[model samples]
Target: MTDSQRTALIDHDVWNGGLFGGADGRWYAADQTRDVIEPATGERLTNIGVARAADVARAAKAAAAAQPAWAALAPRERAAVLRRAAAALERNLEDAARYIARETGGILAKAQLEVAEAATQLHIAAALPLQPQGLLLPSTAGRTSYARRVAHGVVGVISPFNFPLILSMRSVAPALAMGNAVVLKPDPQTPVSGGFLIARAFEEAGLPPGVLQVVPGDADAGAAVVEAPEVRMIAFTGSTAAGRKVGELAGRLLKKVSLELGGKNTLIVLEDADLDVAASNAAFGAFFHQGQICMATGRIVAHRKIAAELTRRLIDKAQTLPVGDPASGTVAIGPLINERQLRGVDAIVRASIEAGAVLEAGGTFERLFYKPTVLSNVQPGMRAFDEEIFGPVAVITPFDSDDEAVELANRTEYGLACAVIGASVARASAIGERLKCGLLHINGQTIADECVNPFGGRGDSGNGGSMGGPADPDEYTQWQWVTVKSTAERTPF
Candidate 1:
């Protein structure tokens, strides 16, 4: 079969069986539907449901209906189910990975890595039930005071198009392990990979009906999931504009939310840094998945002394990058997810050029394939430097001093992640500390290192919550308090 044919969307019960909902592991596929198109070839791969508000209502109602019983299950049992799902994901990782490569337009090796690591994340999150605890207040002796970490009931998960499998688990797996039923609204661009595959995993793993629902769709379908009053909390990952509206709606409804929004993360390459390392990191930052990353390195502050050299090497490295047929084992970069993303990349490139930013390399957009772009002579003030260019456009700005580099890196509203490539670890860390990003790496690029720390961002790049630390997802859903008083009776006041 041709590589193009390898990534074709496989038919599934979610569509063919009139499957609008899944409860007790039985799919009730009776809903309004649509087509799942291949962004790479503009081909209609298969029929997929564009679930209506009523359909969403039925699914959520089913979840809400079943949540309490699921919650009643032993935490160990919950953990066991999650472990089973994780195993099932591992079993089908190849199937899911290929789908991810096709549906999301990410390359083969990277898609395989994403699928494999996403399985690990799910497995890790599945361990949350084992970590649930009650903290005792060190108040008065013999006065029973402790806080229970409990599920927030029905939870809504809204994931974006890029990195669908990984991002989807970034929210839903934790919710499920903590005994909360999940209503997942995976990005329409990644239905087969993230949404459909996830449901299949849970189903094969014998997960209870209504505990996990993967509803594939657009913003409206997501709206249906969010507008449900029974949804106790929402965890969203996507654009800043969309996130704002989601946040506002959640606020009006008084529902708790966790948002992982857009970013214009910068990479700083100091004069003292290794030029080769800087070039490679920058390339990986912007070229991975064609830079559709929310935390991808959008801007670079390279030392003027080495800017020309690094720019040359970056372009040389990017030039050799393989493109086309994401399911092909050898393709390095794939096309944009759809025309919307393709246009967005084009607009950013055009605006950058109009703003007088120099295009170093890869400013070409052909069909859905946007070349890996590198821009030099970029101003820190330009939109290309400040906006989240969710494409492979690397806008490089030069700075004379280390202080200027730090200032340039921290100039954006996004405090997602940033890096300092320097000769001295001490100097790099010092610069990293001064920068205003949630994650700061030394001699590396800003990317999601799944096991290290909190992967979300800050400011316009992140959502409102007291969860600034690198705690597990279950930790955020818990509430803790302490009461101090004597066990002996006190006189009435």
Candidate 2:
């Protein structure tokens, strides 16, 4: 699709002016405005109004005020609304996908997948209301006792730019499903896909006003959401550094916080692994979406017996994948999100090379279009091996023994996702069990998420809280114990 054709898909009147305050279905102008740039062309897509602390407070207050009525509705009623919203998302998938591609520089396929995942999240959320909310408890005195889940008043969702739709919906849908209002603060760079699209979906599905508010802004807006007294919980998806600040503030406020943070994940290729399959998985894990995903494989730990062959195959894949504007629909890789991200990726590659890592392929760019890069002989201390590069770069480190391979993979502090590929599924599963990551894949790639599965990480990647499936109830609601006595009994004083 042409750039103009993509931009024409969304309603210009709603987004052209400024901030979209989902509380009232109105656009509020801001004192400062941020230009949304299409990374592929380095051109201005549109200008979004920057939300401030006061704006966030307004949204939070609205959400708090709307919470009781929303929570009072029958579970079936809520479920019906969520189901309609999921349908709306599917009906408008193409339009939403175009917006995602234009705003985030993702290929059409990736954008469509994101929209599909988002709809799936809503469908999952719809079923949550029908699940049993309370459980019977044993009582010694013949008094009836039970424990039931209740929603927190309001939830604050701070989402990242990459995979904006899916990340935002995973929290927003479940929070709303469990009877909590949400104040979403999407990253400024992707306000439309991350926030506006979601708000529109719910609005179209007949959601009450103030039930969900999308406020796109910077750190100030996020802080306001976290600090607001009415907001009882915060769901954050971003970098580890930023997550620490959010967690500390939420901790001080005594609020519930679910954090899905960064990962310096690894893909392990064993001696008996199929070189072709191992290399394919590594490239897909590291280069998909320009490797902007938090679960992107940052390092490849290969056995010495097969490392050379695996590296050669990886280099070939890296060198051949097409890189250009995703709107063209022909390239396999698109541009980085922005110039700053491009520079960061380049610096990591250069620093890794200087630190004695071999540049087997890639390490070149034009504008924000960074070619997929592969670095060999990388060690524990090297920048590419140690840091979350957040780019299309793969680092390979060879180990002679299974113990050393496990050691190399476990050396990093970030443990979000890991993948093990070997001829023996049993051996691979054993090695995977020895690793410390939260999500493990045997004979597969590292980047994956499902609405039915529990998604989270350990160490710096998360704070013991998870999302999706049974974890959703824990993250979005609190347990309350109730005891009933048919007749009043007097106690000795």
Best by TM-score: 2
* Candidate 2 error regions (>4 Å): 1-9, 21-25
Q: Model 2 over residues 449-473: C-alpha lDDT tens digits?
A: 8778899999999897789987898
TM-scores of all candidate predictions against the true structure: 0.92, 0.97
Location of the lowest summed lDDT over 10 successive residues in candidate 2: 1-10
Could you give candidate 1's per-residue lDDT for residues 299-417 as a string of tens digits? 88889999999999988977888878787777778888888878988887888789998887888877899888888888966778878888887788999987898888888788888
Q: How much lDDT does each candidate structure score? A: 0.77, 0.90
Off by over 4 Å in 1: 1-14, 17-23, 464-470, 473-476, 480-493
Assess the local accuracy of residue 196 in candidate 2 as a C-alpha lDDT between 0 and 100: 81
**Which stretch of 10 consecutive residues in model 1 shows the poorest summed lDDT?**
1-10
Q: What is the lDDT of residue 281 in candidate 1?
A: 92
